[model samples]
Target: MYNALMGTAATTAVGAGLTLYYLEKNSAHANMEAEGLHPADYPFPQKKLFGTFDHASIRRGFQVFKEVCSACHSLDLVHWRNLVDVAYTEDEVREMAEEFEYTDGPDDKGEMFERPGKLTDPIPRPYANEEAARAANAGALPPDLSLITKARHGGVDYIYALLTGYCDPPAGVEVREGLNYNPYFPGGAIAMAQNIFDGVVEYEDGTPNTASQIAKDVVTFLNWAAEPELDDRKKIGAKALLLFSSLTLMALWIKRNRWHTLKSRKIAFNSPKNWNKKPNPPSKN
Candidate 1:
């Protein structure tokens, strides 16, 4: 009984909370639902050459990661093995794997093994643990970059947008207390300052070391991280669905043609069963 009451109360609380949130954001929510103005609705802007992923661009992004963000943030979910899917060669991946240090010890035979990193090794944290990370980043632990493209409101597009959106606060916009001035952040300010800046990292790609380029390339790399096989997955899914749909349609057509006969036969068979199963008027009592 107590569990039932608790469940009821929890459901009521959730309903009430949702009601309040909806009331507060009714206009935005309505606009998003009706027009798909939500984060995932934003389309990735792609051109023939500049927008799409390539080796030079991803390599440049790696350079950016190494020079800037990798000091604090860690992409714990992404393994070095996955880099091959993102256009890295096996040798390049091996070379990259050597950069990260991993922990391993002797086996039962007491033979030492070099267990720094491998193709299958997940990205390790820069800090020892969450407590250490929080202590360094002013109480905000840096999020893993592996799933960042999908986790954010606009996915890769949002990261691209946010990176390029850094600008001066608009005129007449009241700067809220405890908030530094920013126009692009969803909440007008973030603890993280302008991350992408010009001439920050020297790219081996020979592209100009502009903040905009870095931001765009990094976002592209992140998109790759989130869904490396998205195109292949989508293609396979489409083909499978088409086959299933065709089979279903054929089955439906056959069923439609045979429905009357099947129904008649079922009725004929069911009558005897019903008659035999009947109570026989309770033995005429």
Candidate 2:
């Protein structure tokens, strides 16, 4: 009895302690009701159920990423070869890959060497490591944007808002030093300042290089980066849907037309009434 009572008391104490700890953590995190604003529901044409990414926008987004975001953020998951025929041609990717030198293996003399970046190599990192990245960015690590669209809650829309939402903090809002105000971000302060602006990048397609346009294109590119096979996936999904629908209809028709009689027919069982007496009568006849 004592052991059971002690166990019960211990469990209750642990539960109470956990509850208190969670409550304190929640209070710390939920200081303000305004955690962040919902991202704008911009009607991206490529986000359509059966739609594809805009390749032109993807190219522009690549341009934006290279010229702007690449300075701090690294696209570690992507390879130079992956961009070929998706955003840029093979020749272009080859040329772009050649622009960055990569560290190669030691020679016969046991010396490391530098070689041009190959298409197969992962995209160059901005910093050598996390420590260096943090040191450069005032101890704030710039996140790799390879899968950022899928990693975040609101996906690309959230990113777009974040990119364009930087502004002066409202009254009573105190953004600390080294932080910038963006209502779209949780806690309303982010390490990444407003990077996009009007004419920040010149679009080869002649799209006006407004801040919003830049944000949109980059967001699109990030989304594509997150899911490079989106177009192929959509195509496969449509084909699969059609195939399954046809199979389902065919199955229903076969059940209705071919197996209709077998499925619908009812069997009646008759009890032998005069069998015993009939056998005796037949023998007499």
Top-scoring candidate (lDDT): 2
Off by over 4 Å in 1: 1-56, 106-115, 170-180, 237-285
The weakest ten consecutive residues by lDDT in model 2 span: 24-33
The 0-to-1 C-alpha lDDT of every candidate, in the order given, reads: 0.70, 0.89
Instruction: Give lDDT for model 2.
Output: 0.89
Q: For candidate 2, write residues 175-248 as lDDT tens digits.
A: 89999999878888889878999999999889999999999999999999999999999999999999999999
Index of the highest-TM-score prediction? 2
Candidate 1 lDDT (Cα, whole model)? 0.70
Residue-level lDDT for 203 in candidate 1: 77
Per-residue lDDT over 210-283 for candidate 1, one digit per residue giving the tens place of the 0 to 100 score: 99789877876777777666656666877899999999998898888878587667433345656657564656
Q: Pairing residues by index, what is the TM-score of model 2?
A: 0.82
The residue pairs that clash in candidate 1, if any, are 81-119
Tell me the TM-score of model 1: 0.61
